[model samples]
Target: MNTTITSNGLPVLPQAKGNQNAQAQASQPATEAAPAAKADDSVKLTESARALTAAQGDKAPAIDTKRVEQIRAAIADGSYRVDAGKIADGLISMEGQLNGKP
Candidate 1:
């Protein structure tokens, strides 16, 4: 009978003395495998941030798609005219708004 100690220092099952292969196989390490656990994810938001996100759902988009389409069509049809006075006034108005002059 052939007997050997396992990795845990416990006596394992005996094999026939003629089987040198069996002794070698038993001495080799046995890989221990465990099942993987599912991963968990979490997110936290401040009260104001949560309210803003919720409110955004009901608000209109910053850029109107319909207006964009109209502008694109006008440009394609050669009807979109650029007014220097209007642009200059708009720039002045923007500057005033930026300076908080209303």
Candidate 2:
């Protein structure tokens, strides 16, 4: 009886002549496969992202006075508490959604 051992100490079955030939063919370089094609279009940025990049190092647009007053009132009345965990979770969720994995 013939016996074979693998690198991991596992017992290997002896291959028949036809099985060996098949394995050799399988191991040969696959000439039929073609290289991946390059993308024709360049990657695109969102309109908002492009605008933000264009506005980099410039002063941001002025906020509306009514909106600012409302925010100030909310903060003064203790109704504007910051939830760090919620903000973090929201940012993480938004990132996952943007990455197309959500």
**At residue 81, what lDDT does model 1 achieve?**
65
* Index of the highest-lDDT prediction: 1
**Candidate 1 at 8: error in angstroms?**
94
lDDT of 2: 0.59
Cand. 1 TM to true fold: 0.34
Off by over 4 Å in 1: 1-63
- What local distance difference test score does each model get? 0.64, 0.59
In model 2, what are the clashing residue pairs, if there are any?
none
* Tens-place lDDT digits, model 2, residues 1-102: 955423364534433234445555554433332222333525689999888977874666665989866766655444555679999999999999999967
